[model samples]
Target: LLWETMILPIIRGNKLDGYVLGTKLCPPEFLPRTTPGSTVKIPNPEYEEWLSNDQLLLGWLYSTMSSDIASQLMQKATSKELWDGAKELSGAQTRSRIVYYKAELQKTKKGGMKMEEYLTTMKAIADNLAMAGNPIPLPDLIVQILSGLDAEYTPIVTLLTDKISVSWIELQTNLLTYESRLEQLHTYQTDGIQANHASAHFATSSTTNRPFTSTNGRGQNRYYNGRGARGRSRGRGGRSSVSSSSSFCSRRIVSASCHLFYKSTTLFHNLGMCPQIMKCRYNWSYIKF
Candidate 1:
């Protein structure tokens, strides 16, 4: 904005030709003596007009400056001196800004922030640092980001570090992809658990409602508990007339289609086999005794 309004106008008007060419086009001229014994130094009309124009331009520059900054350029006798002073001050500020950005980058951490938020902040700081004249190396930047991630990102960090070389854009893409996959994995697990619970509940209710058959000497029919993979029995139906025995089926071996039945009072699970209800020849009963 300043260049368009102030600097461009001065340049177009050839007002800054003397400064650019390093030659004084409007030289000072001495005035003729008015008295024999009086000594005076009065500038010629053209020199006085040039001095006034330079002063006006310098005042415009100072008008936009802070008090402290203006003070530094106030003593400059020419436009070149003032321009050089302003450039030097700008260079110093740029260096200071670079230092500040470097410090901020070092202090950055993932902490409780999301992966994307942290990465964006790191990227913004890195960009500013580069603009300010302290560009961070890609490898070092990758290491810094990996080191600051939370425990949840440990797997991705390990994957990245195990590789010999990685580019910044590739690293960014991988991190975002990893985060998206993690969210999908988490959602899948939660949904799987809910589905399992619903399936188990439906299986239990259906099994309980179906008829059952008992294989004991007394020939009593009864229903079995469907809450788990355990077995229930009454009296053994062998010729020796042995008392009934109960056992639990291993959950690892059970399938979603597993349903309870009895074979000679020896609960079908005792066969150490997953029972197929549709293939068994036992009679069905609904009594819950």
Candidate 2:
């Protein structure tokens, strides 16, 4: 707020206080002519306005500095003197700050941070470097940005570098695009894997509860044949009565007499049958054993 509302306006108005004592001393045009032999001299016509403007600028400069800084510049009568003093006083600090920011840039990395965050930090460091009289070139800045990225971006970086001239803006756009594509690919693969797992589970369950199987003759199957099928119990005279239920195999059995026969029962036994939301009857025997 201070910079925009006060400092910028002051600078733009050409009224920013700075050293001008030397310029003030120089004659503009010619000093008013003095009588030929008389020692009396005429004042420069602009001296009054010059003195007025200088004092006004001087006051603004003094008011803007901190007490500590103001004290050091108190003796500076002109705007230029104050400015030079301030720069000389802050030069060491500025150099140190530049070093700190450069070190941070060198050490910073994307790591788990977002791409935007990393780029923003790098830009800030670059700006500070420029302010410190060490402005980075566009290509060098782009290199620094790429160097700080995570290892995951290596392939993309390689691809981009190989294909086109690398610019910071272009790299940033490509990186974001790549990130979105990776997220989509991961989501697609995850959904596909879940779907396949669900399919396999349904198939296994179907095979396990098959209506009838030769390996387990007239055994306890969830779906029963409509035909009166019989099974021998453990005892010699033991009798097995078959009952039908629509709770299971309701879709596969359209009629009480309908039966299912697979071309490769063994294959189905291992992999199970595909799950169907609706069952349909196909050619098969409703045989009596």
Q: For candidate 2, write residues 132-217 as lDDT tens digits.
A: 77788877777777787777678887787576467777878888887776666556545544554554445445544334322244
Best by TM-score: 2
Residues 1-289, model 1: lDDT tens digits: 2222346465548656465234655566667656787878776888787777676766766676779878876788766667668777867887888889888888899887777898899988888777666789888888988988878889989999999999888888889898887777666545544544554555454445343455656655455445544355666563332222221212321233233222222322332232333323142231121
RMSD values for the candidates in order, in angstroms, are 11.5, 11.2
Write out the backbone clash pairs for model 1.
212-285
Deviating ranges (above 4 Å) for candidate 1: 1-53, 56-99, 111-115, 151-166, 200-254, 257-289
Ten residues in sequence with the least summed lDDT for candidate 1: 241-250
- Predicted structure 1: lDDT: 0.63
**For each candidate, what is the lDDT?**
0.63, 0.58
What's model 2's lDDT at 140?
A: 74
Q: What is candidate 1's CA lDDT for residue 151?
A: 88
Q: Quick one: how many clashes does candidate 2 have?
A: 6
